[model samples]
Target: MTPLRPPRSPLGRRFGHLVGAYGLVALTVLLFLAFSLALPDTFPTLDNVSAVLSNHSVPAVLALGVTLPIATGKFDLSIGYGLGLAHVVTMQLIVAEGWLWPVTCLVVLLGGAVAGTVNGLVVAYARIDSFIATLGTGSVMYAFTGWITDGARIVPGPHGLPAAFTDLYDSRFLGLPVPALYVLALTAVLWVLLERLPLGRYLYVIGSNPRAAELVGIPTRRYVVRAFTGSGLVVGIAGVLLAAQQQIGNPSVGMDYLLPAFVGALLGSTAIRPGRANAPGTLVAVTVLAVGLAGIGQLGAQFWVTPLFNGSTLLIAVGLAGYAARRQLQRRRAQPSRPVPEPPGTAS
Candidate 1:
């Protein structure tokens, strides 16, 4: 019997696969060039670069926090409320109770971790759907935030915030804002974890197929819980940075970051390693967003346009991610199967 072979994919199919994989990156570069051309005086300058870096760093960090849960095929909606709670707690400790800044920062970070563990327990052990569980937990966190602030901002006392604390977010290093360095450091850490570590492999396996991961003896529930816990820790750090930047605790500030963070994470799934959420892709997505927003703002767009842009871009990102995932799946399906060997010495 003759060995059967799958037909070669058409040139158009191969080209479409390549485009699906790299289209977002190309789009980002093109957008930057277009903006530079349109606003040559402002968009292409170092000062604008610095401003975008400083302004978007917090959202970028927050987006990374969400990306972890996303990688595990879970959603964490409580990050926004958790961020507000952590920062507000930091302010209350430092300004109201006169606690040391370092101690306050530590306590706030631990609190965020605890909140994350609770979310994990609810989602993993209690068997609640992640979206609903996180939404409920986030609402509770919001209530706690309101209670802490009494619906008011926590302004610093007579001494004001320590210069060292404020400098964490406001200072520059090597001609670039320190926050940008923080983003780079975090991205490196996450990339190593997700791409190079055993723990990361397990998480990816779980995300890709929970049932198969469990059958393979991977601790699906435990790893999912851990993912949420890790996300919480990152959220805590972001909250501390947020406090340092604002120098005040506003209970309502955290929700503003949620949409942008989700936008970056989801948008990122379409680029770099398509069909998966990865650190490099998230960073790229954030850069695209930051540049677009900065260019539009410099163009004197109305206030409502920013939110509208973000919302619309999010929808487009989701659509693109689905398209990319589908393309990848189709490409895999179209690949030829291995050739079967002939019987005994009758091979071709």
Candidate 2:
């Protein structure tokens, strides 16, 4: 019997499969060049690139947080609301109750973890659909934010906060923005966890097939819950960073970030691992969106173009992911099933 093989020559395989995966990256670069050529003096400068990177850091972190739940075929719509509530809680702790910055940050992180635990319990134990569960929870979180803020904004303290705390967003390291460095460090840690650890394997198993994972004695519930907790923790951190950056906390600030964060996650899944939500893919997706939006904005496109671009890219990403999944299934189906060979010396 002949050995089974993948179709397409090596080069063809690389180009065909990887092209869609990296298409957005190439598009980002192309758009950058076009904008640079058109704007000449304004668009392609180092300062502009730095500004884009710094501004995008929080959203990038949120997007990366979303990827873990997504890998397990779940969504956390609560991230935006969670972020709002976290910021509110952090401010209240510091300004109203007179807590120190470190203590307040810890409390906020804990709140996020608790919220995520509720989400995980509903999805994993109650077997509710992730979408509905997160949506309902998200509404509650938003309500909390509004109630806490009294429909108003929370400004910095009288003495403002500690310089060290605010410096998380404001300071520069090695001539690059500090927030960008945070994003890079978080990405590196997560990449190691997702790609090198046993927990990573279990996550992939659960995402691929929960039943199979359970049959193999893996605790799918625990891991799923952990994914949510981790996601929420990261969202909490993002909230803190936002507060520091803006020097104020408004209930409406988080919603604008939601669409772009999801866009980055969806777009990321199409790269790196093609059909998988990997850490590197999520970062690359954010870079592409940041670059594209920066380029478009520099070109004097209408402000609405940013959201329009994100929405369109999200739809295309969904379609591409579906197609890739379907193709994988078809490949599995098309491979010939091996027949049992006749027993040696037992002629019919």
Candidate 3:
């Protein structure tokens, strides 16, 4: 007979869980420290800190947006395209049409919602695979982007974009970049929505098992639609921020963020709440990428290094995420089954 192992103490189990949850966070800190030590002058400076935050905030936001649909076991490949169109439109409205900054932002956000709704409708009602559907939608959005820009960049006039618009991306808040603050606020909101709300639970359930969720009377399709819509809205916000920061809208800028956003979101699944996508985890993942890239750049890495790193990280993250998910499922299977309650008036 196999020897039985001693049961773990509750304290020990809790400690283990804590480490598992925050291990990536710890890794991020370690990477920062190591780089700071290695490149004392540049890596540890406040200027470098601000630059990294300012440069990466948009990608971080996009990563967070992608996390929602991922939490529902879906992907939003069209986010980059949505982002491209949203920002271009923002520029077209504000720079070309002389629309007020506030009005332009609102319209762009609404357009994002509409785009997300179309993606949701196509995926849920049409019963198409999210990967293929989003890709198709994304291509269409890219086409629209091209049409809007006429394959050219949108440069503002001599007066420049409104200060209010540029401030959205350029201003600092309490010594931190405003865009970074936006990322933090968005992360907190998504954390609450995904981890503390019934909506989150419903989405998680659907993600884990659609049939099981349906059997439990959860509206999986509607929730899936909601997930995609939320993603689109967040993408819209990021696009506006991108436009504000770039000041000159490039039709192809959206795709630049795509890889890093996905890399962050996927790698994040293997940390924090392992086997699951969470907002906090996504933030942590983006930090890791940002730090690594900043450090590499400071080390005089080549231009191609960034994409290579992102692509490699993406593949590894996917593998680890899949392995972690399987492990979680196995753990569930290993647990003792609960006894079913006897029906009322049917048993003693």
> What is the lDDT of every predicted structure here?
0.87, 0.83, 0.91
Predicted candidate 2 versus true structure: per-residue lDDT over 1-348, tens digit per residue: 999886779799778777867776777788788878988898788888789989999899999888889888899998988888888787777767778889888888887888888888889999999999999999999998998889999877578877877897989988999999989988888888788877767786688778977776777898899899888889988888887787777888888888888888888887767776778888888998898888788778997888899899889878876676667556646778433223223455
- Candidate 2 vs. true structure, TM-score: 0.90
lDDT of 1 by residue, 1-348 (tens): 998876657886677656766777787888889989999998999999999999999999988888888888899999999999989998999899999898988888888888888998999999999999999999999999999899999999888999989999989999999999999999899999888876777777778778867776777788888889988988999999999988998999999999999999989888777887888889889988998999899889999999999999999988987776676657656787432222223325
Model 1 clash pairs?
A: none
Model 3 global lDDT (CA atoms, 0 to 1): 0.91
Q: Which residues of candidate 3, in runs, are more than 4 Å off?
A: 1-12, 335-348
Per-candidate clash tally: 0, 0, 0
Q: Which of candidates 2 and 3 reaches a greater TM-score?
A: 3
Q: How well does candidate 3 score on lDDT at residue 117? A: 88
